[model samples]
Target: MQDTLHGDSQATGSGQEEGGESPAMDPRLIAEVRQAAAGDRAAFESLIGRYQGEIFRMVYYRTLSRMDAEDITQDVFIKAFRGVETIRDPVMFKPWLYRIALNAVNDFYRKKRLRSIFTLFSGDREEGQAPEEDRASERLERKEFWGWLGKFLTRLSAAEKEVFRLKYLDDLGIREIAEVLGKNESTVKTHLYRAVDKFRCEKELCGFLKEEKP
Candidate 1:
């Protein structure tokens, strides 16, 4: 977000970030969120109607995907809808909802990391490399800054990537990230430091990539 590898797309606030009802969402959504908390399926569906797009956008931007994000968004809602009934306070649902969304992103990344690892070991990657036309179709998959940043993320140990994604992509304060991640704030900061160091090194590599001149 703060560190753009190239063209920047503004990171708008999440729906709840609008505070006390988002214009982008129906006012009924507040009722629905509360209802879902009370085990109302119909109300939960209505809640999904309101903020699904926002959650999807967050996932898609960070994951650089639509299909994957779409699947994960549904997963987020299903988890939320089920857990909503157990949540004690409706007011706290916003962050609770986001935590679900974040988990979806993490799961998506884990699956991707596995795919990449498999591809690396299979030698079949050469036969399956993207065709030229496919490259154009998938171009948004290459937000220059994020594309580079993601490579570094993949290189990180699982704990480090989990910690870093919360700090940077989710923009959670270090303390908040520490709570979600079950680490000391100082430990979280160390992950952020390591992640940044890795990102800077990778950005340097991109300069070399650009120098290739086709």
Candidate 2:
């Protein structure tokens, strides 16, 4: 993986993990990426076409807003294209792209000083009538869980927030998350444990999790 991220020879070859073609990529798509990295416009477009929907969903799940998510999604691809050469391991491109999307989200929040996740709870409280999608019981539940998460997440350090968000909400495995955050697997596990402990202790959310299907 380290070799792949560094040069054209590495990028142009098939990605082999554990002595074979990577389970993470289709061989054809890998070829297209290699071509694109060599200045093939159509190949690059193919890459973008393949990833757009998944990337948009990733952005939306984090931002919880269509408008901002759309904006950030576009930004992510543009950045990916403009900086494709900066990507060391083309095989891990999806996770790499997600990392960019996540960074764009963080930057957006820093600039706007807004917390979109909290917006999920407020829904229409300022207007006094919640959106139909967010009824009273649901509103109460979301607010309660969110309030708990605030205190819980706040207890975490910065790296813990990124690791927990990626591992839990994003459902990324430890190695994938390690690649994304540039951390080791054990560190990722430790953070996940700490974050989950807080999550389980959250008064309202604990019951919801207990009731949730496995």
Candidate 3:
């Protein structure tokens, strides 16, 4: 989750980076993905080692609960392990894994019958209630962006909200997002553009994001 993009630029249909660099998939990782798909236990374990933290963080960002995130992260990998061979292209391992995580999160919410995934505040707090000033300031600081973000996102349609999160927070490019959401690139772009238009109108949030963006 550094500034660097995760997958190969060309395979993802993104442009080359500065200095004319077009990063390719690492051969060793590609081998691991293929081996895991072919039922190599060690290779699958290696893949788990590389992605576990990222998967956990992604789940944590959505769930906002360590316990739920951990459970969902485990379930996501379990499902992935069972279905790895279904992934036809090695270049798509990251997005394929992400798709699994997204479904797992949705299923979690569906069973719980909780608030929409768009809700930002955690715990027993009611939506639209201001959190007590002294409550878990450190954790709030970490998630502060989302607190501000949830306000703007409330006005967006479901498709727009998701497209925005995938593009900006999840750091998936448009093509990868389309693959994950089972949508066409043009559809993804339309949603993303509408979301961006809404986001640009929120001057305070836009300025805050500019200052906070990594």
Candidate 4:
């Protein structure tokens, strides 16, 4: 989960690294998606286990609220379960799931805006639990990175920001991002190109990336 959350920020602006196509799906995972789509409860639960951690992390990154992330994660699976049979290509299950998640996050924000709420998520961790000593520093650094990245994302258009996050932060391939966003490959690339162009010019973030190099 931490690894997913702390994805390579430098990768965001590195053009075409993920290739134009999605990587081939594992046959077994494809089978699982197919079975789940056929109403097999166990298969659906298996899908949940496989993706829940990353889904939770993705949601947490967007909402910054542990509770909201948990609820949305559950809702994502519920919605997926209900609609799995509509999926034409089992190989597309991953991106399809992400599409659901991205929609759910957008809906979350929309509802908040509708209610005229100015304050966002609390982002608090559970009380009385401490991170392991070995991971503490890494967690703090990643937290700081997210804070900076969040600020930077505000400069991008909605399309550019979403493309950048899905590509670099969430490690989606271009085809997968297109599938998730309902855009074409070229459009995805265009948004990514614009985002990366801006990202490269961010001097402070570039300096931080240099320090982050191994």
Q: Relative to the unseen true structure, what is the C-alpha lDDT of residue 153 in candidate 2, on a scale of 0 to 100?
A: 73
TM-score of each: 0.57, 0.65, 0.75, 0.80
Writing each residue's lDDT as its tens digit, candidate 4 over 41-107 gives 9999999988887787788778766667889999999999999998779988999999999999999
Q: Give candidate 4's TM-score.
A: 0.80
Clashes of each: 1, 1, 0, 0
Q: Residues 1-214, candidate 2, lDDT per residue (tens digit)?
A: 0011122232312333311222566789878777777778898899988877667766765655556777999999989898776655567776788789888988977865554456657773322223423542455655455556566677788788777776655556667777788877788778878877776666665676566546
The per-model lDDT (C-alpha) reads 0.65, 0.67, 0.75, 0.81
Clashing pairs in 1: 5-145
Q: After superposition, how far is residue 45 of candidate 1 from its true place, in Å?
A: 5.1
Candidate 4: residue 116 Cα off by (Å): 3.4
For every candidate structure, what is the RMSD over all alpha carbons to the true structure, in angstroms? 7.7, 10.7, 6.9, 5.5
Cα-lDDT of candidate 2: 0.67
Best by lDDT: 4
Poorest lDDT segment (10 consecutive residues) of candidate 4: 125-134
Q: Provide the lowest-lDDT 10-residue window in model 2.
A: 1-10
Candidate that would win on TM-score: 4
lDDT, model 4: 0.81
Tens-place lDDT digits, model 3, residues 3-76 = 22243223222343312222467999999999999999899999999888777767866766666788999999
